[model samples]
Target chain A: MSSFVERRLSSPVKVAWLVALTWVGCVYALGLVHQPDVAGDASGGFWALVIALWVVATLSVAGLAGLKLRSKPGRLAVDLLTPFLFGAFLFFLWEVIVVGFGVPPALMPPPSAIWERILVSTDLLWADFRQTFLKGVLAGYAIGCLSGFAVAILADRVPFLRRGLLPVGNFVAALPIIGIAPIMVMWFGFDWQSKAAVVVVMTFFPMLVNVVAGLEEASRMERDLMRSYAAGYWETLIKLRLPAALPFVFNALKINSTLALIGAIVAEFFGTPIVGMGFRISAEAARLGLDMVWAVIAMAAVAGSAFYGLVALVERAATFWHPSIRK
Target chain B: MSTTSIPLVGAARPGLLGKLWRGNVGPVLVVVAAIMVVWYVAAVAMNWQGVSERFARMGQDASAGAVFWQTMAEDRPMLPVPHQILVELHKTVLDVAPTSRRSLVYHATETISATLVGFLMGSALGVLLAVGIVHLRTLQKSLMPWVISSQTVPILAIAPIIVVVLGSIGLRGLIPKAIISAYLCFFPVTIGMVKGLEAPDRMQRDLMRTYSASTAEIFWKLRLPASLPYLFASLKVAIAISLVGAIVAELPTGAQAGLGARLLAGSYYGQTIQIWSALVVAAACAALLVVAVGLLEKAVMKAMGGRP
Candidate 1:
């Protein structure tokens, strides 16, 4: 027994396994004990066990990370598994603590209950996605980004306008642009149109500013080389400047993708035609449907991530020559 | 291509008018005037329908010129003209007593307080998390991805839930809004700080290590100072986003005290001018806040012997 203990302590991986086992054992022991009815009334043993689990888990994770797996596949697996395991363990702990304490689902639904809510509410989630993401956010993002780019081109051509407008534009962008949601609803009436307008307003200036900055990205030497070839303004702009500007343009796009979604969602809160993520979130919360709200939140999280990922994918392909993308 | 085309350096070489013409202020003024003209025209075109209907209701004959002026001065124009918004802003921000609930200044103060609190909390949390992640290899691998994922969820979708849930827990008004603002603000600061903290090159880090410096010593002497520029930049972004968060928080709660509430009230009553004024005030507040951060950056950088 003394030799086995020494062997385990001598190896990082063995030490990690020992710590993880102890954590699980403590959790199992805690599971056997009667938990308090309320989180506020948690006993000293419960608190002590929770603190011990945190320390044990932390040590295990740190030890695992410190192991230095030699094989490429092994390192990759460890890299991927760390976050996945951490996230899963966090959810498991949350579910256990909430359920064990008999906490009200209305206040904080356990992960299992939220999962069930998500499973049952597929139709509602799809409808909300259609109303918010498809109709409002997509349309607005396209319109806003295109117009902003077009204006940026025009502003680049006209230095006077560029000098004049950039300051005002930045100021306008900095405002609580979400505040326009209510007024847009009043103007466009309680529908996706209003939401789209809010998104357009929210996304426009960021795109404009980034694109304008991007147009100036080509250094003096690069421009001088283009001029040496006697390339016209449009020719120089298309071949040299725009390519250099692609990275900056993509930055704006990524930002606008998230902003457009957020703007559309928030616009729905004021007044809307029944089906939308923002409307459902606000309405369900009022009714204390915490599980349903979490379900919608999950939908939003997935959609937003997908949207951002799509932009990033396009950016990587388009800006492959850029230093950030170059392998 | 032609660096010489860049304007000459400013010195004691020009008259006031010449200087004004060459300066940013003049071009900005010209653009502002041009926008005002276009806005006035748009206001007349948009408000004419409602104003003319009122005129019809009163059985009065009105010329186009009279109608245009009337639209510009309407109590609640469909699209508030620039002058109408200016007048409304004056009344709400200056003419009305500061203590009055109707005053924009009072609403602005409420919003600003919430924004400041949220910004401070978010920045502190972000720096703390960034420091831990940088020091802990496990946390960097585990938490960083989740941190990125957390931002993908629309804040609007969660703001209402957070407000409702926290409200149930008896955390009301300022705290909920601050949390939401912090939620929005922390991401940029974390990403920026992580990059900032890692900014010192391998040589510099090795130098510190060769000196037998402790982890805290290296972080304080090398990493923290190197991170200042990035930290300040992200802080400016965080502060602006926090202000937006505070306003959005107010919106979902139907609160009656902040700039968001003022916007909601204006929308409820179809008070276009009121909404415009509130928006202007919010914009001015944002500009000032950003400028304040920029000034602080300058001061700190100067103190640290960095170029401002």
Candidate 2:
């Protein structure tokens, strides 16, 4: 029996099966606590039993994650399953603790309530998505990035300007740029335009700094080669330097994707139309409608992630030849 | 990087002027001067309409030059001239008593206190989390993905929620703002520290093992020291964002003490100059915090026998 147990420990498949069984046990224990009669008033002994089961399940998952699976598919499966199980367990704990203890929805709504709120408020969420993400974030991101790119090229040709601008750009990037949101609101009026303007300022400097750094990425040998071919500045830029700068440019893009969302949302807090996510959040929060506030936050999270993921996907496609992406 | 070393082609002579030209001071000054000029011009142009309207209401046919002069001195200009903002800063920051609610110093202190508290807590938590993740395979596998994805979420969007919820629970004032600041900053620290803690190579670890150096000794002597540079780099970033987080947190509270509150009050009253002054103070706070971290990094690095 000891030899059989040692063999089971050494085999990845067996360890995974053991982990699965422990998780099942945890779920069953959770079910016991989640019952209508037991919830919010479970006995101390019962709580201890459920918690002990959870601890075992967590340890089992960890053990499974720690196993050295040699096969590529097996490794990939474990890689994917570990985080999934961890996240699922977290949600499970959140649900059980909040519901079982009868925590007030005002203070902390369970995930189930948040999900239900999302399901019921699709129209409001979509409108906010359109207002903030589609209008403010996209428009401002495009303008800011393009202008920064143009100015970076101009600065590259003028060595003095580059020297003057790089430090300033870095300084501006570090500032609490969202402070300008109120000024933008005053200038553009309380609408998406102000939010877009704030995003434009917030995004421009990072893009400029990155593009300037990117422009310098082409090595001396590469530039000399272009010179030997009599390739003009624009030609070298388009064919060689710009391509080399793809990674840095994408870095700026990825950073700005998040910044743009943040700028737009925060700008709305200064003032915005009633339809935007920030407005909903600040308004609902003030009125103590935390579920709705969380619902909006959930929407913002999904939107922000989707925006960042989209940029990253584009980056991968554009800079496939870059070492980082190739790896 | 090459751009910093580039001397002015025509001004490469041996003199104070040439030395200044070669260094960043001259160029940065020139750039700042240019910005001021542009700002003044934009200020005049933007405030032109309002000034003209005022003149028209007074039934005075003011000349273009007169109108231009008036633009620079409007009570609530569309864009306050640099001098006007400077004057406002002078009044609010230096003229008023530091303890007064009306003083920029008081507001800055309020914001900075929250920022520093949050930064300290967040960075400590982050380093601890990083140490755990590096030492525990289970943690590295289970938590790293969530850490990265958490950043993708615009965590700042939930600042108001956190502030309000925490307030409802009677955890008000600086604590809630600090919590928001902590949330904003911890991500960078965690990412940086994780990379830092894992920086020691296999050879280094093997050497430690050969010496019979325990895990604690390896961490304290090798891992911690190596992680210092990365820690400081992220600390610089973390401090700046922590200030931002604190400022944003102050917004929802509408509490009249912090820089963010000043900004909100200014916007509500159409006090353009007040807003500009508050923004400048906030910017100064961010700059000082970041520079402080940088100086601390340099000192620590030097003491550790590393070349700063």
Candidate 3:
């Protein structure tokens, strides 16, 4: 290598530095405009606060850029720090823009407000999580997916049923979740179970369709080879078709993971005993507690990501041979 | 050639309906009929016990099936009986009453108008975000995972926050709905578009480069064209999600109108039939929107010099 070890900082890093300097000047100018006597309550001094925060932000960004400007190991330190600093900057920007612009807290609570809510209301969030995620989503996802896989297997065996069922499944899919959610609540009552039922309905058809397609993924030649070995349908399905179908199955799984979460959450909006993300969001919005609503949102997002990540990990393990996974 | 001849053979045959029905329609019908029969029988069996007792108390000795149908008919907005919904739809479509909230047609038009606008805005945002992610590999790497993660955060959980945030900022009505719809619709479009845009081969890109074309030119000519299948796939998904998003947004704001408002209104008053009818209308609307997208996909594909 000519000099692989002696690389320069990326263009983004240089831009970050320039941005830092400009932001510092703007903040300093803004600080000058802040008059303590004229500052109007929390609303009035918001701009000055943003400017003060910007000053701190500039220092942090500059420090990060300087670290990146260094060579090798030092640059690596910046690479790790860059994301955290960027995240901080994003939170800062969100806070300043909303406050400085005099944005209503009801619509978009500042990041600090969201964090405060998170800090104060761990127990409520946990209960909501248990209702929506643990009971509703997990149960519904498992049953829906398992039922879909089983039904798809049966449909594959009975070709006529396949022809008959798929269109109807498509019909079922076209029924909007909102349309069915309340009815489910009526039939199943106002608990996690109703939400679970909605999830089952929402997830079932996609999985069924995907699995049906996945079952067909085994090539004609592969099936012939399996047949030549005197294998039965079940044996061929298990040993050959199942392996080939892993990627498609996992595709459905990943898709269902999202759908299930959505279904469970939306279903709760129709009716609940009141401890749910949907309920909290609805109630909080009514109360104009935008910060608490945001806090709940953050929890849902983290949980959702974790659930998706778990599914993705399982997918990687199950479909290691898939080209998409390999990449 | 085989594909061309298959439908031709069906068209050429007399008694085609019977032949088609035997192979396809018959089984589906049989299944539905059987399911209905079983349901009817079960209702008859169960009707003797639960609701029958309640009906008796009310001086009504109705059969389980009759009570079920009556329940469906009486259920407001969302849970309308299949027959009642058909009747209400007729009344609505016929425009029998010009000035009543009870008129299904009036409510539907109002809701659909907003649903469509929000849907269009959401889809546009999704497409733009997808383009950005696809064009910037770093964004694709960093933002893609985050976008996927974003959905896990329940829309319900965030809808109020969004509604209140916007409301506080003096933004209301369609904007909140559109924003929520965008949140739902964008993720699919972004992921789908990223996959679609990258669907082109290295050889294709190299050929484009040989023409001395700018990146923008290459994108419009090659990347975008290659992305059609993916776009359509996601558009269907995005559109449905957009409808749902619009509905959810309605929930937080307590909007006096829209399908969501209708649903909430019915639920609050326990107007089960009204709720059912509204739900049916919404489903129909969603289905129609999906079909419209499918039709547009066909037109676009045909224009692209391929058979739809």
Candidate 4:
């Protein structure tokens, strides 16, 4: 047994086995929490066992982190698995504690209950997703990004406007731009359009500021080279400045992706047509349908992550030659 | 690329007016003026139909100029002009007693209190997490991904739920709002601090090792000081979003008291001017918080012997 322990502790793959055993131990502890007597009784043994499992799980995760992986794939696997295991451990703890204590679902619904609610509410969730994410977030993101890009170009052409706009843009970006949601809802009525308008306003300044900074990224020498080549304004912009500006533009895109989702969802809190992630969250919470609220929040998390990931992927493709992407 | 066509104003005039025109202030003022003009036009256009309907209801055959004037003066205009909002702000923020619910200053105070509480707590938590991550390889590997991805999760969608849940548990008033604010602000600080803590290069670490310095000593003397600039940058972001979180938290509570409550109440009653005034106050609060952080950053950086 001592030799087996020593062998497992010495290598990355063997350490992964230790991690797997600890994970099993955590699952077994969760099972113990699910036992009938544990729910009703505040037992000392159950608490002790749970704490012990937690310690073991934590140590194994730390051990996994300390592993010296020699292969690229092994390193990548560990990189991905560490966070995944940590998140799993947290969810497991949440489930165990909630179930063990028989805590009120209203205060904190367990993840299992949230998953069940999500499973049962697909159609409603889909409709809200369509209304908020598709109509509001996408439309607003595209319009806001394109207009910001155009204005940045125009501002580049006119230095006077650039000088004036940069400060204003920075100032506006720092302000609580979401405060305009009520006004947008008032103007555009309580539909996805109002949400879209809110998103547009929320996203525009960030894009403008980033793109403006980006447009100036090309060095003096590069600009001079373009000038010596007798490049026209459009030619220089396309060949020199725009490429240089790609990273900042993508940074703005990533920022705006999250902003657009948030603006749309929050705008729905003002008023909406019986559908939207925000509307559902607020409406359900009022009714104390905590499970459904958690369901909506879970869906939102997935959608937001997917949207941001999509943007990052596109950014990677578009700016592949950039130093950051290359790294 | 040719510069000969335009004469240099500084060389020609060398006056204050010329300096203002050539400097940042002139263009900014012009832009602001232009925005105001556009806003006035938009206000008139948007309010036209409502004004005309009211005129017709009152059996008055008003001229175009009269209708335009009425548009600017409507009580609940579709879009309130700048002066109407300014008047509302003056009435609510200046005229009313600071303690009154009708006072914008009262609501602003509520929001700012929550923002400051949350900002302090969130930044402390962020610095703590950053320190742990920097010291513990396990924490760096495990928590970093989640920290980065947390910002993408639209965590504010759960703000209402948090407020409701905490309120149900008797954690009412400011604490629930502060938690949301802290949640919103902490991510930036953590990300910034992690970067800042790792900023000490291999050479610096080696030199510290050569001195036989303890980890705690190195952290306090080297990492903490080096991380100030990043911490301040993130603090600026955190403070702004902290204000946002406070306002949003106030929203789901349904017009109790706060700038967000003012906004919700105004929206419910079609009080466009009220909403605009509340928005202005909130914006001012955000600007003040961020500027305060920036000034603190400058002072601390200066005290640290950083370049002015």
**Where does candidate 1 stray beyond 4 Å?**
A1-56, A70-73, B1-15
Model 3 TM-score (2 dp): 0.82
Consecutive 10-residue window with the lowest summed lDDT within model 2 chain A = A1-10
**Model 3 accuracy (lDDT, Cα):** 0.73
Q: What tier of docking accuracy does candidate 4 attain? A: medium
Relative to the unseen true structure, what is the C-alpha lDDT of residue B148 in candidate 1, on a scale of 0 to 100?
A: 87
Tell me the deviation in Å of residue A88 in model 4: 0.3
lDDT of 3 by residue, A22-72 (tens): 457455534433334322223545556566666555444444443335367
Say which candidate scores most in TM-score: 4
Q: What is the DockQ of candidate 4?
A: 0.69
Worst 10 residues of 3 chain B by lDDT: B1-10
Candidate 2 collision pairs: none
- Candidate 2 residue-wise lDDT, B203-225, digit = tens: 99999999999989999989999
Clash pairs, candidate 1, are none
**Per-model i-RMS:** 2.9, 2.5, 5.2, 2.2
**Native contacts recovered by candidate 4, as a share?**
0.83
User: Sorted by DockQ, highest first, which candidate order results?
Assistant: 4, 2, 1, 3
Chain B TM-score of all predictions, in order?
0.93, 0.95, 0.81, 0.95
Tens-place lDDT per residue, model 4, A1-327, is: 323333456676667677878778887777777678777464888888878878777776776677777899988988998899999989998988888888999889888889999998899999999999999999999999998888888888888898898888899999999989988998888999899898988889999999999988998889889999999989999999999999999999999989999999989999999998999999999989999999988888999999999999999999999887798
True contacts kept of each: 0.73, 0.72, 0.47, 0.83
Question: Lowest-lDDT window of 10 residues in candidate 4 chain B?
Answer: B1-10
What is residue A120's positional error in candidate 4, in angstroms?
0.8
Candidate 3 lDDT over B1-308, as tens digits, reads 11222455545554876676647676687667766676545444433354556677899857767666554333232333346656766765566674467676666666666667777776787778888777654344334555665666666456666776677678987787777777778777878887898899999999999999898999999999999999999988888877877777777567877778888887667766667677877888888888999999999999989864
lDDT of each: 0.85, 0.88, 0.73, 0.88
